[model samples]
Target: MDMQTINTFLSTTAIELLIKVGAAIIFWIVGRWLIGKVVTLMQAAMNRNQVDPTLTKYLGSIVAIALNITLVLGILGYFGIQTTSFAAMLAGAGVAIGAAWSGMLGNFAAGAFMLVLRPFKVGDFVSVGGITGTVTELGLFATTLLTPDNVYTLVGNGKVFGDTIQNYSHMPVRRVERTAQLAGSVDPLDAIVRLKAAIAQIPNVATSPAPEVNLLDFKLEGPVISVRPYTHTDHYWQVYFDTNEAIARVGKEAGWPAPASTQIHRVTQA
Candidate 1:
């Protein structure tokens, strides 16, 4: 070919290439901005509607990912690429991915079950997956737990859903049990009465059922008084400690008499 023809060909090729790249760049930027706006708007709506936070976050991520994929395909189409065929190819790849990560997919399935079954929620104390803690975040694949000592644990949904789930915060009321010990020499009935009185005075202790104080087991040192108190779930720890303290104080006021039997010898016997 002659120089003139070659120059014309080069010029046309450069312009076409530049246009494709510029179009791709513009689409990429605009698409990203739109994704952000959509996610932000959806987040606000979810918060306003009181959607479960975990589900809301997971749904927003899925939407953003789907939109971004669409944007990429559109950009590819501008470059004379066959996105329809590409999508079919992706479906085949997806099957391979599912096969490779079957366990992960199982976790995903379990997570879906948790969402539908509603066994627990954020802030609920639960025991699952051989661990116990407060549910902090529920995700599509795993659940986050915050233990009593401030430790964070991530347990797979598959394991969590497969095992027994103990939700301590499920009930409105709970029982708190403690024991007050008195020397066996003291009258059991009197100790029981005073211990029950002390538990009743504690704030938030349930009154309808009343506190039950009974003579239970006997130890070498003293007689055991079982103190069972009822209270709201939220006040469980508070009531537990308060009732214990009360029992100790009441027993002390009556005197901590030594157990019935003891041995003593006189040095002057000889």
Candidate 2:
């Protein structure tokens, strides 16, 4: 071909390529902005309807991901790329990834089921996946927990769902179990009365069901008294410590002897 013709063809191709690149950039920026706005609006709407915050945030994330994927496909189509073939390829890749990362997929599925079943929500004090803590977040693949010792933990949703879930905050009150050993010489009935009175004075103890001070069993040292106090989960630790103090105080006031194991030695005579 002539140099002049070649130069003209090159110039045209360069201009077209630049235009396509510019359009693609604009499309990407516009698409991303639109996706953000859509997600925000949907979240706002859910909030206005008083939807659960956890579910709203989860749905927002899912919608944003789906919208972003659609936007990318649209941009590809605009560039004259066959999006149908691309989508088919994406599906094939997803299957391969799902097979390789089956645990992740299981966690995702478990999260969806948890959302629907409503077993527990964010901020609930629960024991799941062998970890006892307050739920910080119920995410797409994992559940975040802030433990009693202030440790942050992440448990896979699959494990959480499969394990036994203990929701400590579900009930209005929880029973604190404690035991007190009295000396063999101490009157069991009198000790029970003193303990019940002391436990009743402890702060945050539930009044309806009342505290229970019952003789649990007899050991070599003394009779065992079960000291059970009902209190709200939030005040459990406080009440637990206070209950122990009360037991000590009652024993001191009654001047009860310290519990000791009794043993007897028999002397043989010839």
Candidate 3:
């Protein structure tokens, strides 16, 4: 009520606000420095361990965000703001958001599972959810794939995890299986033996497993000779192409008849 009392009250309030402000500024600076050091150390550890780049970056970002958030809340609390109440409100809001974005949360969960399980890693060619490509990046919500055509594709982790994942590059060796079609007149038993021998000549085909050739089925045109060749995954395409070419060459030399053409004759009603 008095002028002196009013002046004293105003001075005290201003001094307290200034002190809180100064302390907040100091805390922020110190906290950020410490956070930076911690993050740098973490990155160095990851690099030393030969961790995947994608995972390392993701982990660092998450850690940085969490630390920064803690710093902000600490600063806010220093200013006499009720951070506990704020956190409670945020938790409630997070629950609502989690429910609202259930699908996105599912993707996050799936990504976490994928990281833990290590089903496939970057640079591995995988088939999931009908999309086959090399995994370029694995994010928190989706997996980025570079298709054979060089097109970038994004598949949600939730869907990919739910579906089957076939990692063709998981192992060092890959088996190339092909069915060579032959004309009905061709004798498969003899040709199968010869073809297997010819396919074995390919240098890329591995010797440990040994090449195999057997008659798979009898179609309208001829017998289908199943060919299984083992080779290194990196040289898969070359082996596949060379094996296919060899099959044709061997089959032709063995007097295997060519496929008969299918002629569709549609006569209009007169």
Candidate 4:
């Protein structure tokens, strides 16, 4: 090739390279700033709606990433790169990744739904899918809890929403049930009447509902007395402890022994 032609070609290549480099850097900086703004907006929106902090942070990150990707593609196209093929490749790769992590995605979707619906919130005691604990944190894929014994547990959001949730803290009032065994000879009618009176006197117990005392069954030891009473949820523990003590004291004062099974046998020798 002639020297003149070589020089012209080199000049064009250098200019093109500089333009591409400048475009990429500008796109990166502007895109990052814009995504940051979007994330801030998302956080503001979440805060306005009282969304959980964990979920708000996760959603903001996702929005930032999506914005960054879009800006990157636009910048690439400005440098004369064909984005159709690139977009297709991205879509294909995304599909593969999505298929591979389908379970995780389901958890993410479920977590989003949980965030919106708010079936339970942090600090609430709930039982779901056989796991009982107080909610500590909620995330896109999992929810963390602290058990009564203070053990940390992480349950997937998908499983949590998919299964039934027993929210013990949802209501202002809760019922406490206790089954006390007595001698079989104890009169069920008298025992129930005394239990009702005893439980009634306990502080925080709801008088409107009236405590229920039922003879559940007669066992080898005694009759099983199912004593249930309604109390304010906040005073659940207090009522539970008081009611238990009251039932025992009342039964003793009423002259009724918890029932017990009786057996008799005879032996004859020839």
lDDT scores for all predictions? 0.86, 0.92, 0.87, 0.86
- Could you say which candidate leads in TM-score? 4
Cα lDDT of model 3 by residue, 129-172, tens digit: 78999899888799999988899999999999999999998886
Give the TM-score ranking, best first. Answer: 4, 3, 2, 1
Which regions of candidate 3 fall more than 4 Å away from where they truly are? 1-11, 43-50, 182-185, 218-223, 258-270
- Give the alpha carbon lDDT tens digit for every residue of 1-270 in model 2: 999988997799878888998999999999999999999999999999877677788889989988998999998898899899989998999899999999998998898789778788888899999999999988878999999999999999999999999999998999999999999999999999999999998989999789988999999999999999999888999999998899999999999999999999999999
Superpose all Cα atoms of candidate 2 onto the true structure and report the RMSD in Å to 1 decimal. 3.8
TM-score, cand. 4 vs. native: 0.83
- Can you write out model 4's per-residue Cα lDDT over 1-270, one digit (the tens) per residue? 999988998799878889889878987997798789879988998899888787788888888878877998898888889999989999999999999999999999999999889999888888976799889887878989888788999999999999999998898778998987887777778888888888888999998688888989878887788999998766788999998899779877878764556888889999
Which portions of model 4 miss their true places by more than 4 Å? 1-10, 182-187, 214-224, 233-238, 262-270
| Best by the lDDT measure | 2
**What would you estimate as the lDDT of candidate 2?**
0.92
Off by over 4 Å in 2: 1-45, 67-84
- The sequence of per-residue lDDT tens digits that candidate 1 reaches over residues 223-258 is 888999988866888999998789778868888675
RMSD of each: 6.0, 3.8, 5.3, 3.2
For candidate 1, give the lDDT of residue 143: 95
> Against the true structure, what is each candidate's TM-score?
0.68, 0.78, 0.79, 0.83
lDDT of predicted model 3: 0.87
